[model samples]
Target: MYRKSKSNGKATYDLREVVTNIKWSTDLNFSAGELTFDLIQNAHPIIPYTGDIITFRWDHYKIFYGYVFKYEVKEDNTVSVTCYDKSRYLKNQDSIVWQSGTIADRFNNVCKRAGIKHKVVDKPTHKVSAEVCDGKTYFDMVKSAIVKTRTATKHMYYIYCNYDVVELRRAPYKKLKIIIGSKSAMTGFSYAVDINNTANVVKVIQKDTKKSQAKSATAKQDDPKRTSFKSTSAAGKSTEQWGKLQETVNKKNKANHAQMVKQAKDELRKKNRANKELTIDCIGHIDLVAGNAVTIKINDLGKTLKNCPILKAEHNFGTDYNCHLTMKVGAEWLGNS
Candidate 1:
């Protein structure tokens, strides 16, 4: 009797080359009755054979990608796979191409082997009213969502949901979060929001904006120009305060630029100094200061003191002067003789 040995190498499986190149669709149907793969007349149907596996993904929309569960076929041509989901539909509904199968039967076989118990419902659960907000950059809205959700929910972690923000009337509530650059000519202030529970974040923004506007308004009453300044500032209109703010921003930018330049110069100087090949020629005269002892190279002993310019020739003349100092670097320092 000969038996086929299981091997990951190509020789063991005849159709290994065939299975590797198959095109698979990401879309899956998750209805209350049962979550099932939508089959379209073998266009993207599951190949009915051993060693063929399909992974069950739970939150395809989030960062935490789903896992894969192994499946083995029984005599009935139907197979069972284990998953973390515990739902009436999910309980026994997950199936492969049994030649023909529905969500319920698929759910049962998988659930049985996986030891997942679930209730069988006669009808599908009603769809929840949710929305998907796509592509609309919800800068402040998303940021506010993060803060509020972070404050409110403990288990819900914020992940930057990067997708074409699609706004749907019913489904998951989608807040269109976009990142507008500082140079972007957008009217509103930009913010980085947490995406833990975005709906709550939007609500918080709505709540917070009102408070901000109210506070702004109340403050404007004390300074009438403040309101006018803000309104006009959007259109590039300049008020004294606005000018001051602009000046501050400009000055900060200029200071940053200057500091960067200075740092670069210092770095270059240090690098040059470290190079053994590099030499620094001192062109300027060094003057002697009185009361400060001087060390001259023996060769420089009698060089014309005229060009060298005495910085300090005498010191400890306690009788007439504190210390006579002369230098090209500084003014002459000599008291009454």
Candidate 2:
């Protein structure tokens, strides 16, 4: 069901009977959670205009609150509306010179500057040294802070929309809390694994080329002409299993030997893993969005994954209440097994 609100007057709309073709989807890699629905006009004498407020609910649970950014009139007197949560504003570009703050701190500052209501659920324990944004979107700023935090503290944070408020949270914010089997809602499943992106060896090199400034003691240890450092993370076992695939990253400024090593290890940790994915079909869970956790137990294989991440969730409220979820499992690539 949904309610439409405007300045001139207030009106309530029960979409249970009047609206058809209702669907909502969200992805962890995307910035927006969308709502698409077609409203039957003959059943109701109401037409939602652009910029109108849409308060959508499912079974009395507030699912989304957004503005009507688009609307189309059909020849059959039907209105199709598309709305997005507060993350829509993240698309705007801005120039910000942010420095010396934690990820939570920068998130608060960005939300405040963008007029976005936000809350920090799980604060990262690392502070950002500095970041300069020139003609970058707000989401890009958030990502910069996240990258710095992850590199320094080895923690990954997830961001999502809670109603109209942007929430900066950690992983496993919400659990699927359902079993998957023949006896449960689990209907069918398919799995695949690929090593196209696998990289057992990662190297990070730092270069300092400012000739005007004096070099530090560490820089003096290297070639006197210039300062350079290289760090590598190579999984000897994985390299033998798969071929030797290496990649290099270069930075303009300077980082200590330890920092460079940490960065290389981080890169190896991510690239070394194979991409394993599971596509599942089951009954719809209204609260199950991207970045949530779901547990799966395969009795035949005698395997159970406790913190499987939900990468994409598409909930359909059309003919039957069902959802299709794509889970990106971080389980190490098992070669061709």
Candidate 3:
């Protein structure tokens, strides 16, 4: 959508008519937003070359931006272009030691070093501990910092790129009050619930300074934490429903016992549920991208599900604009860090 002029200039082509089959994909599990479209070479007197900036905007908001990565010209004088947002650069490998500051601070540091423009939304104040990376991709280090924050402060966040800058946001950053139901313009719908990753028993293991394994089954009734000598915690829920799907966590002497106990409880809360996903497609809304929340009101599902988190969304533009999504069951499904 834009070109890098040899002189200082600012402009973008109005590509609405010359471009066709535009597709923009955003996924929480993917590193970047992607776009592909066909450009009619002859429709315009001049066409930008490779490495030119491309962007898509809807109304007042700029939705996607990236440089032209690939382009193919055919006998028909039509060009196929593929682009990816700035987060694509996060795939590059690096090594560093982040000693202090919240996850937001760490992300900003990474962006500065990588020469990528970035912004932050809904910051988490809890500071993450020191982390040293020998060799890891920038994306991997960011994910690692997120996991550390989740373990310590129990807050969740996600990353994406739009409007020419990478954005780090708390999970479900964009919230809409609108509801989607069976009456919506749905082309397809499928909701599934499975217990594939359920767990009811969590065992905590500790190794001594001498490098010996230790597991004791003694505790003091007077202590509320019950962490005096406990190494395992089991959910009160009947194991008959899910027979002792066990998980384990290792800790060092430096970690407090109470923290370990709460860690076990956290594991149980996250793993004991039936993971539910509702996949659907309808007429596209520019705002309906990933890392947002949508309300669902179907007949079979009661009030148990509201504000479901969107895991991925793909908006296809051709004859019509349509979007489909993969969404989780409830707000907790996204926030249960």
Tens-digit lDDT track of model 1 for 164-185: 1111111111211221122331
TM-score computed on alpha carbons, candidate 3: 0.81
lDDT of 2: 0.74
Tell me the tens digit of each residue's lDDT in model 3 across 121-232: 7788988778898788888778888877876766778788867879898876877777776667566778887777767788777643332254557862333333344475
Rank by TM-score (best first): 2, 3, 1
**Reference-based lDDT, each prediction:** 0.23, 0.74, 0.74
User: lDDT of candidate 3 vs native?
Assistant: 0.74
Per-candidate TM-scores read 0.15, 0.82, 0.81
The regions of model 1 sitting more than 4 angstroms off are 1-14, 20-151, 154-337
Better of 1 and 2 by lDDT: 2
Between prediction 1 and prediction 3, the one with superior lDDT is 3
Every model: Cα RMSD to truth: 32.7, 6.1, 7.3
